[model samples]
Target chain A: MEKSTNIIDCTIRDGGLVNNWDFSVEFVQDLYEGLSAAGVEYMEIGYKNSARLLNATEPNPWRFLDDHFLKEIIPEKKFTKLSALVDIGRVDPNDVLPREESVLDMIRVACYIREVDKGLELVQMFHDLGYETSLNIMALSSVPEHQLIEAFDMVKKSPVDVVYIVDSFGSLDPKDIEHQVNKFKDMLPNKQLGIHTHNNMQLAFANTLTAMRNGVTFLDSSVYGMGRAAGNCNTELLVSYIQKASYEMKPVLGVIEKHMLEMREKWEWGYIIPYMISGVLNEHPRVAMAYRASDERDNFVDFYEKVTSPESTIAPASK
Target chain B: MEKSTNIIDCTIRDGGLVNNWDFSVEFVQDLYEGLSAAGVEYMEIGYKNSARLLNATEPNPWRFLDDHFLKEIIPEKKFTKLSALVDIGRVDPNDVLPREESVLDMIRVACYIREVDKGLELVQMFHDLGYETSLNIMALSSVPEHQLIEAFDMVKKSPVDVVYIVDSFGSLDPKDIEHQVNKFKDMLPNKQLGIHTHNNMQLAFANTLTAMRNGVTFLDSSVYGMGRAAGNCNTELLVSYIQKASYEMKPVLGVIEKHMLEMREKWEWGYIIPYMISGVLNEHPRVAMAYRASDERDNFVDFYEKVTSPESTIAPASK
Candidate 1:
């Protein structure tokens, strides 16, 4: 059966957090080719964040994607279309060329609940510029119901083609995912829904499948789950699991064998104790990720104590 | 909420598959104490498979547990109860001491669909011996509908305290788990249901949670998912995620830190590509396990081709 599901590969974008967008041109090319051969619909090549605003001294092609650079890399595009993610205020409108002028087909705007209006503004700009647009609301687990309702009021009027429920904390189970998807569907009637998941507590694949089962169209995945903290859903798992006959697992496995296996050995990602603790506690993985970088990384009992202590429970200064 | 759920840790029993039941006495003791402090209901210590039948030269304590040895290991019983699994034709009935004489509380009988009659006979023997019993129907994904119906008809009449739906292949999703739970519940209303899951697709926790939501009581897990290929659901995840208020996660984390971390380095388990491929294909992990041990272990593309190709997929001589 042909489903409306469009897999969006986020290897270079979300996975940038692990390597600071240090993906080699060769690896990215291989990933693009593999995903295309596997019949994946779109690939979020990288962030469209501007270098001037971010004060980036580095010349990372993936961090600040240039149309000319992207065309040079993947000169001949295949079945997989291109997309790029942008954080609020990080990406300048001037940097993103109109869709027909660039290799990218979509420009996704990611934001917290408070920045929904700002996200929609970017989405509107992208939509008007002849590109598909999506507004990803991160940390849905922490957002208040009233806040979501208020955000949806603006979102419902936005020209965004897709709206995503991001499991930023990687805390949600399938039941929670079902509830969120239903809420998203109810709030955004005409819009397609997408799911972006983290693998803490090993629920990423399950949560993504739940969203798909609930009619979520755009499923976000990274090669071998190469993203931030516990990482995102595995692109290979999705390709193998999704019932759509067009989707092939062999090509995904090909890239995993040819590139990701070596990359995984060098990079730190996937299920780890601290990340699992944060997810189970429904807290952000920032503290856990920091702890993992420290010398006491394997001291999970100590880490658990430190996180669960009364002092760590206090609200941040921003609150 | 005080739910009727009982978590059974199969760390040593199922994890034995990884290292051939070579757990140190000290580690087993530590696991028992940790699980007890964490308020886990039961710990499956090891298999009761007779060494005489298997012709074992090795004195693997966990594989062939002795009543006297168990008493010496856990001299004082804590909150956590003890259990051991037995396979049909492998365990000598005479080796099982009466519940009143032995430290073990439960004796679970695991068998295939074709061997349910034999499984129940063992269950009846255990029941007569004053031991709490369970019938674990393994490789449920391979079993036909009529086979399950036949097995359940025998299972429904058995003097068993729990009946488990064992996803021996790690092939099921949450929806499949829910459906199976419903089927078990409808067929055997009087019998308590247990769930034993593997993490091949990282759906173990989600599937176990789904079963719990549907009122299945007995939940099987292993410390850091230390069972066979892809392993069982993480015991810490369940200890942290289950909101029963009393299932303390600190002790679980303590054990994982104190022992499992080093053990994980020595043995191979948890989500690997081959295990995941087998799970996605709904096949047993034996071939995948063999592939993982070969020189070309990381050659996932070759493995995918070999498994998916027409020649390798043909039935064995038995079939």
Candidate 2:
């Protein structure tokens, strides 16, 4: 399993949602070194979304990653390769450099089920640019069967290196993950499969292992589960459990002890009541995240009532 | 699954290991009303272990639950039944009252694999006393195959109502749990199965679901995952996910908001790094628990090195 498995650390990429890409260059540099030493396969630095489209007056190095800037931060490539995620319509084709010229070895395109065609267009461009590519279809639990069939029609023929089953809502259990993995394997027989999970039900690590056991290659995780609400799987758990002789847990622990322990205090992530409620209902965490920021965060009974009420927009979980 | 399923919330019993049985009578009363309203099947109030044998000078209401004290705290019985857990040889047989005369509906006996016979003896006595009984085999992960076979031989003849797979070290994933459930089902063909999990590696909920999927009926959990070292599976998660038409998430949430939020701040639990490391290594968390109390609690890199080093006793996980 370790031979086929690839851990893609997404601390700065997904964790940016919690703290607005506020990571220091020193911290990012230390993380890169630590992950490399820990034998992590790839590190998703951040999004490569266009700065102009977002109307950013100030520089956000991580959100709008530049090839030249990335090279400076991670001057020399080590054991771990670098990657960046890009959303459909947010990335400008002109901005992407050839793989030989840029520090990034792969570029993942993330989108909803309806945007598979748009996502593949980016995948094709990235593939042709000599970089490894993956198309991560987000909010997978909510995608209708017909939409997946339509999406798979394009996905199977796309030049993407991997197709990711992204549990954006953190709603899935191991059984659900197995069903989706088998579906992906059947639909995209020629491509490798990846897993991106959230820990709302504390199943991120379990679900990731399920995917790996089912032959998925890429596993997305974060240091101390530092991502959006409920967070991603802990990279340390994966590293320790994978049973790869080459993998080391100490380096991953090193960076966490040095930086993440303090960052956790400043920015909230990991499992919370609202996030768990959202996941149980199979809805996006936006409402829960909003509630967490407000003064009524700890009032879990009210939050449960608000979300599960008939008048509320949150649809019941499909099961 | 919910039709046959019985949720046994162990917040006071298992959680007592973390707080030294320091819970107030008012808090216990609130928990009883809340769980009853939530339609939970049973609540394991605390230990039925004897104060006479342990020489307890102070009144440890929950730890050494007197039927008189329980009657005073609960007053009137609601929808939820009451259970108490006792260790083999630790309980004073004279202290237990017959079911017709006592408030306790069940008495669960917890033991190591080697103590199966002793555990069953207690279970038999409890059963003859007109109480439902269970035998919980602790540390299922490290028990040798031969030990399990010998233990199961005795367990199969026991009069215990339920046989439990207890992950005392929290060292199991869903795959391991599925394998164990099949073993339990194969060996003890006539008995019902239960699952008691800890969150050392955050697989408590996932493993419980796995067991349930395999037809285990008894599910053990705690509020806010508040048990010893990384805690137990969350009762809230199971209540919400089970989709039992009668179960309500609000009452569970209500008690959590009213009591657990403040309790969590004072008493440590959930997925801390040391507990996780111990789980991944398939070892007891006593070392990690002691380290956490020390000044070097957050020095995870050192802890990882110390545990994995050849000189240490920490055993590698059995895959």
Candidate 3:
């Protein structure tokens, strides 16, 4: 069994995609406090992308992750640390300030398999500025073996301390996680390995445990399985399942009880028919998402035909 | 991969344990017609146990599953056959008529590992009375290896055609299921294997799939994962995930649309903190069930401590 590592919950950041960053400041504040008490290592406030590029008209807290706004939301640092995420072309380097001046402790960079070079650029900038950094390779299930091998060669020299195996499609089983963990160990043996999983095929918890047992250091999860599509692994599940005293189960449950229940009611994520079908077919969940948005999503035959139709081919990627 | 065989949906029968057999005849009839259209092989309408013994006070229509009442529920047999469950000492053999005269086709018997002989008694009677019978050995998780070995010696010679590897506590993993399947195959090579899994640990679907890939022929599920505690495997998920042409995705979806949508609103099941804690502790879900019934049930820390208390020990087995 792998020793207990830090848990970094990205419910707000990843789950925001489901509702277009519609979470209120109060919700975020409550979540942060609960996560702090729960002994969570990090609570990802939201994405640090510039709103101008995404053209979002909504209150862009998740899009910008302003330093002033974050300070106001989390007035005091408790047991939990703070982190923010950025995409390759969506972020501005100038937006991040010194670690002490800002509430953020870490800045994570998420990019496609092809964008590793560009993603390393952000990792270098963050590392230079004294912020702990990680480079997350997204959609790992679709990445070719050679591409990952080449990307790891470049990533090994970068300043990032953590490299993640993202199961964006929720299609991989425990064996897949084991293979990916082994590959990470062989390629970037010096850097810590992280795992992010979705529950489309109900493999998130198992796959996460598998990676952890195989020496992965970072585990990503959310409360009540709230994230994009089938949602990330449940934070509460991990906290209680792990045999570590430092990982507090109370704070994660507090978030679930105080916020995530209502959030689940408002948004459509987690296991639904369309998501499960997309997962089994190893396709994107777009058709399932569209069907779920409609009144007829529960009509399995109609939903199956619509998704498997000759005219429809592209599956919905994770947000 | 093993060829897919019959899928027996016991949403009402197995799920009734969650709510104590409170389903109306109309709901059962709707499920029967719906499963038939979806090409489900069997519909387990309800248990045939005597309510007097269990002291169950719920309405008796779908509770006891009367053969005369079963005829009225589905005037004509369709693509889906009918099945009912009976527990040791809970059923009277007189209630079950021959399959030719009754609407029920299969009579499944549930028993603890110690009661295999008694359970086989009912199986022999049901088989003699001309009904396809199965012996579901409940809670294989906690049963000692020697007990199972002794039980299988008698089970191999019984009149039962199907012997199920039941994960009543939902605490087993895929590896556990693989070991159990091998043990059952070695013991009862002449009989077919069935799988009845609970989702206390969120591995029910995966375990079922693992069993199928190994050699199990019968798979049990419910609509939208509605069953006792963490619930059974989702019927919709299994139908969509498997490659069985006999399973038409449409009818299952219709059942979800008409019944489960509103049903989900009324009851809470699926992956939750309390259930996950029980699975992690390798314990039964009774503590989780108790928490869910209490005001502090959603409190993860308190739930964890209660289930892991020194006095909690191994939960006594109950149907």
lDDT of the candidates, in the order given: 0.91, 0.92, 0.83
Which sections of candidate 2 miss by over 4 Å? A313-319, B313-319
TM-score for candidate 1, please give it: 0.98
Scanning candidate 2 chain B in windows of ten residues, the lowest lDDT window is B310-319
Per-residue alpha-carbon lDDT of model 2 for A1-319, expressed as tens digits?
6687899999999999999999999999999999999999999999999998778888999999999999888889999999999998888888999999999999999998878899999999999999999999999998888899889998888889999999999999999999999999998899999999999989999999999999999999999999999999999999988988878888998998999989999999998989999999888898888889999989898888888788865434432
Task: State the DockQ, from 0 to 1, for candidate 1.
Answer: 0.89
Candidate that would win on DockQ: 1
What TM-score should be assigned to candidate 2? 0.97
Complex DockQ per candidate = 0.89, 0.88, 0.48
Candidate with maximal TM-score: 1
Candidates 1 and 2: which is better by TM-score? 1
**Candidate 3 — which residues are off by over 4 angstroms?**
A24-26, A55-59, A98-102, A182-191, A290-301, A312-319, B24-26, B51-59, B186-190, B272-319
Docking category of candidate 1: high
- Candidate 1 residues lying further than 4 Å off, grouped into runs, are A313-319, B313-319
Write model 3 residue lDDT over B1-319, tens digit each, in one string: 4345778898998777776666767777788888888878898888898877778776576667787777777899999988889989999777778878888889999999989999999999999999999999987888999999899899988989999999987888887899999999998889999999888767888888888988999999998888888888888777776777777766777788778777777777777767877776666677578778888765666665655666754343543
Error of 1 at B312 (Å): 1.5
Count clashing residue pairs per candidate.
Answer: 0, 0, 5
